[model samples]
Target: MVAERTSRYNFTPGPVPFVVSGGEGVFLHTTDGRKVLDGAGGAIVANIGYGRPEIAEAAKQALTGMGYVAPLWPTENRLRLIERILDRWVPAAAGEAGLTRCFLVSGGSESVDTAMRVARQYQVAKGRTERWRVAGRATSYHGATIATLSVANHDRRRQPFGPMLADHPKIDPISTEAAIKDLEAANPETLAAVILEPIVGSSGAALISESDYWSTVRQFCTDHDILLIADEVMTAYGRTGTRMGFEHFGPAPDVLVGGKGLGGGYAAIGAVLAKEFVAEALAEVGDSIMFFTFSGLEVSVAIADRVLQILEDEDLVNRAAKMGAVLRARLEEEFADHPHVGDIRGLGLMQGLELVKDREAGTTFGGALTPAIIGEAFKRDCWIYPAGSARVPDGMMFGPAFIISESEIDQLVSITRESIDAAVAGLQS
Candidate 1:
C-alpha cells in the first residue's frame, strides 16, 4: 500500500494524490503498487511512452556537455531540431506555403502567445497597425496564458479572468457562416489574425471541423488579409495520424504552433512555425521576436530531437492511425447500443465519448456526471480525461500512447465499459 502524505499546497484542495513511482510504456506504476493504464497518456502528452532510455541519454549528454546558452543564440541541438522540423516534421501543405521559420518556446502557452505576437507584428510591418484583434472559436482552448485566454472561449477557464481577458470575437467552431458573420461584425480591418485548433482539445476533446468548413474559412482569411494561426499544440507531431492536423484540411495556416507531443513528454518545449512572408515582414521591420528565458535550451532541444527520431524510427504516427481505427471499431461495437452513449467521434488516436441523457433527442447528462465517470474510471485502474462545456456537457477523452499493444487496448475498452456502467449505476442509486 502507498504511504499517505500531507502537503501545504492546495492545488486541488484535498489530500495529496497518489505518488507515481515510475512508468513503463503505457502504464503508470503508483507507489501503492497499482499499475494504472495511462488511458489519457498523462493528458495526452506521452506520445512515445514512458521510460525511454535514449531520450534520457540525449538529455543527459546535452546537459553535461554544452550546458546553457542564451536563448537568442543558436546551438547545435537547436539548429538540428529546427532542421528536423523543417525537413521532416512540418506538413507538406505548410512547406508549400513557405512556412520555414521556427521560433522555439518553453511550452504550448508560450508558443501560442508567440504566434499571436508574430501575427500582430506581421500586420504592423505591413503598415496595418490597426489590425490587432484576434478571433478564436467558442468551444476551443488555446492555453492558460492571459493572451491565449483572451482569444479563447472556454467558459469555465475564462470565467475567473473575464475582466482581464481581451474581448476578442469568438465564432462557432463548426459553422463557417457563423465565423464569417462574426468576423464581419467584428470588422475585418481591425482583426490581425484568426486562431483555431485543427482538432479542439481540452475544452471539447478532439472536436474536428468538417473539410468544407475549413476550406471556406481558409478562403475567407485569405480574402480578408487576416493571418491564420493553427494551434496544433495537441494535434501536431503525429497525434492526429498526420504530421500536422491542418494537413487533413486544406491551405496551411500562416502561423503554426506545436507542443505536447513535440517532445513526447521528454522535455518542456514548443515551437511556432511561420510562413516566409510573415518572417520576412518581421525581419524587414528590423524587430526580432524576443525569446523565452529557457527557449532553445540545449538539453531540452536535444531531448526533443531524440524524441522526433524515435517517432520516425518507430513510425508511431502511422501506428496511431491504424490503432485509432481499431479503437474506434471496438468502441462502436461495445457502445453503439449503450443507453448513455450518445456520440463517439474523433480522428486518429484522439477520440471523445459524449455521454447523454437522451440519445434520440441528443440531450446531455448533467455536468457532474462527467466527473463521476472520471472518478469511476480512476477507481477501475484506468485514467481517462474528462471534457465538458456548455455544448459538450458530459464527455471523456482518450489518446493513449502510440505504442500501446492490442491487448492493452482491449483492457482499456473493458475497463471503460465497466467504469461507465458503474458511474451510471451510482447516479441511479
Candidate 2:
C-alpha cells in the first residue's frame, strides 16, 4: 500500500484535507465532489465572485495587445484604471482635493509599504527630516513587510520577527484618544504619519472610531501637520458596502491605500492615492520615486478596469449592503441567545463572532477554543476566517463577496451556527 498524501490541509492539524478543484459564483466545488459555500470569500477578495468572464476577456485582450510594460512607462490600461478610481473616490464636489496622484503596486502588502514610504518621503520633502516614526492602532494589521510589521500590532505575527524589525522603524500602538495625546507630547518633530485600517480586519475583526473618531483624528493630524494614511486594503472595492471605508467617516486622509478586491481577485494590483498637497510635496523633492516595478503591466490594469466597471454596472456594492443586513439579521436571530457567543458586529458584509468561555461572567474563549472551533468548522465544510492573536481571543470573521447570493448567505449562516454549537458541545463535554 502507498503512503497517503493529500492536496491541501484545511487550516488544522487533522487527518482529513479539503482539496478544491474549481469555484464559480459563490460555491466552491471540491475534488471529492463536495460543493461548499465560500463563506468568507477567501479573506474577502472575491468581491465580484469567482470566474468573471468579463474580467477574463479584458485580461486576454490586454495580453494580446500589450501583455507587459515597465512601471516607468505609461500605458492606456493603467491610465484608465487610475481614472476610474479617481472618479469613484474624488468627486467633482471636491475637484481633486481628496486624492491628487496614484501609485500602483502588486497587492495589499505592497500598497501598505508604498503608503508608508510616501508618507515618510512627504515629510522629508517638507523639510521635516526628523519625522520618521509611524503610528498605528493596537491589533490592527498592516502587512508582513519589515516596515509594515513594525506598524501592525499582531503579536503572533510580529513576535518571531520583532528582534529583526525592532530598530528598522519606530512604531507606537495607541488608542485613538491616547494617540492624539502621545503625538502632542512626543517630539512633534519625529512623527511622520498615522496609519490605520478604518474598520479593523483580522485581530478579531475589531473596529475603532465609529463616527467622531475619524473626524477627531483627521482634525488632530491637520492641526499638528501630520499625515493620515487610511490602509483600506480589505475595506475598499465594495467590501464594506461603500466604495471605500473612509467614506463612512467625515474627512479624507492625506493618502489612501487599497488592494485585495481592487482587481476582484483576478489581477495582482494595489494602489496609493495621494492628496494634492502630498503629491506636490513629493514633486518638490525633485524626482523622488517611491515604487518601481514591471507589475504596473497593462494586463493587470485592463483586468482591474473591467472589474471596477462590473462592480458599478452590476450594483454589487448595494447588493453587499442588502445581503449583509440579511446575514447579520439571520445570525443575530439564531445566536443572540447562545450563551457562549459574546458579540457579533461589523460594517457592510464584514462580520464577526467573538465567543465567550464563561457565559455568566462574559469571559472570552481564548487559546485552544478558537483553534478548536475553526478546526470543527473546517470539518463541517465552511470556510469562514478564524482571526486574532492570543491577546484578542476567540474571533471568527466573515466577509463574503458582494456577488454572493442570498442562498449562499443563508447556507453560510446555517453552517456557522452549527459549527459554533459543535465547538461549544465539545468544550462542555
Q: Best by TM-score, which number?
A: 1
Instruction: Please write out the lDDT profile of model 1 over residues 1-429, one tens digit for every residue.
Output: 122343444455432246788999999998888888988889788999999889879988898857679998888889999999998988776788798999999899999999999888889999999999999998889999999999988788888997899878988887778777888898989999999898888887677766677778788889988999999998999987898988888889989999899989889999999999888888997978988889987888999999999999999999999888888898998899998888788888888888887788876667767888878877877889888677777888889999988889899988999988988888878
RMSD of each: 1.5, 2.8
Each candidate's TM vs. the true structure?
A: 0.97, 0.92
Residue 76 shift from truth in candidate 2, angstroms: 1.1
- The candidate maximizing lDDT is 1
Candidate 2, residues 124-193, lDDT tens digits: the string is 8988888887777766788888878888787778888867764323223325566666566655567788
Off by over 4 Å in 1: 1-7, 14-17
TM-score (C-alpha, index-matched) for candidate 2: 0.92
Candidate 1 global TM-score: 0.97
Quantify all predictions' global Cα lDDT against the true fold: 0.87, 0.77
Tell me model 1's lDDT, rounded to 2 decimals: 0.87
Where does candidate 2 have its weakest 10-residue lDDT segment?
Answer: 1-10
